[model samples]
Each structure stands twice: as structure tokens, then as C-alpha cells.
Target: MESYGDLLNNNKVIFDDRNYGFWKSRMKSIIGGIDRLAWKTVLEKWEEPTIKDEKAIHCSVGRKQFELIQGCETAKEAWDILQIQYEGTSKVQSSRKDMLASRFENLRMEEHESISDFSSKISTLAQEAVTLGENI
Candidate 1:
């Protein structure tokens, strides 16, 4: 059997509209979730009794989400934000394996499953990230 990365790199799903849409929606949802988490983290550190310009904060967070979603910067940054967001999650305390497993649950599922599964899932995700390159 061909590997997941091989299939992804081979353009197996490149022309599939449904798959594309699914990935797009999934990515949007993931980014939104991450953004909200990050915003909450900022809130924890924000010492103000109440936010005066909530609209500005929302807009700024939205824009940052856009940039990160669009792949304007390195995946390392996105991953960092994800870690931060996960840190702010209600039950998650340590920013370690448990945290990553909780945050990227889907991705973590294949970690101990199979190389093919791991490679394939990651490959498709990487492709999605690449798609955001010019849009950022």
C-alpha cells in the first residue's frame, strides 16, 4: 500500500471538490478554535477589570487568526500559539504531550497507529498549510 504522504504528495485529492471543501472547513474551524483559545489566554494576563475597546481586540485577534490561518508565518508559530491556547484550556495545565494530544487530537490519534497513517494525515495537513501560502 502507498503511504499517506505519498498519496497526498501524489495529488490524489487535489481535484476532489468535496475533499477540498472538507479540509477548508476543518481548517477554518481549527483556526477559529485556536484564536478563541489564544484570546482567552490574553484575557487571563489582561489585568483590566473590563475591556474598554472589545471591538478592537476582537478585530486584532481576527486579523491575527487570518494571518496564521493563511500561512503568513512559519508553522512553528502556529504550533506555538496552539500550545499557548491549549495552556489556557480549562483542564489542561502542562504544555507537554498531554496538552498536544488534547489540542491536536486528530493528529495524535495516528501517532502510535501506523507510519502510513501518520505520514498521510500530516501530508494532507501540510498541503493545506501550503495552500495558505499566497493568501496570507
Candidate 2:
């Protein structure tokens, strides 16, 4: 839910080219929970950098990704298009899974770190995995 969380904090979502899961989950929570009439307004709030009304998406997306959503009438449509474009195929998903698994395997709590810091580190990684479709 990082994207939605960023939006809630009045910050633009920071997306790397690869982090589709994090963005998609947050989008689902927002879009799925709301009624159809509320879709455009909510999409406007998160994607537009300005508070003024306009028929556009002005968020922090890449140029190609931005092009895919041009003239989209609803945030839901834009989100769907983005999912199709960036979610990748099964092989890509497998590769990402393997990479994350290796990182988690090498993780260790540093001796000098406070208990809170250690817990937060663990929690953040765990949250990331969960967002990426890990059962844990």
C-alpha cells in the first residue's frame, strides 16, 4: 500500500520501474472499496499534482506508462491499463520472487542496532514480501 500511503501523506508515489506489486495492492484497496461515482474524484486526489480540476493524470509516472493512460476517463481504467502493462509474465514474476528470497535469506540483525530498529527492519522486509504476493 505504499502508493496509497504516499498519497495519504500528501506525497507523490515514488515508483521504480519494477515495483508493480506495491502500487497494485494499494490501488486495489482504494478502488475496490469505493463506489463507482467516487472513482474519478479519488483518482484525481492521488494522481494529480494539483488540486484544480482537469481531465488528466499528472502524477509521477514514467513517460511510456503515462502514455498508456492518456484520455482515460476514470482512475479505474488507468489502473487497469497500468496493471496490464507492468505486471509482466509468469517468468518475470518468478525472477522477482527468487531475487527477493535471496535477499531475505541473507538478512541479519546487526549487534549494535536497537531492538526497535531491528524490528522495523524485519517488519519492512516482511511487508514488502507480503505486498509482492508472498503467503507470509
Candidate with top TM-score is 2
**TM-score list, all predictions:** 0.23, 0.54
- Could you tell me the lDDT of residue 81 within candidate 2? 68
lDDT agreement of model 2 with the native: 0.58
Residue 102 miss distance in model 2 (angstroms): 1.7
Mind giving the per-residue lDDT tens digits that candidate 2 earns over 1-136? 3444344445334344676666555554444444454455554554543544322233645566677777775565666567556655667666767877887888788989988998887776776677657744
Question: lDDT per residue, candidate 1, 1-136, as tens digits?
Answer: 5442333344322212234334334434433344555344433444343533222212223343534434413333444454344234434443333433443445665436788887777665555443333111
How far does residue 52 in candidate 1 sit from its true spot (Å)?
A: 57
CA lDDT scores, all candidates in order: 0.40, 0.58
Clashing pairs in 2: none
> lDDT of candidate 1 vs native?
0.40
- Can you tell me which runs of candidate 2 are displaced by over 4 Å? 1-22, 36-64, 71-77, 84-87
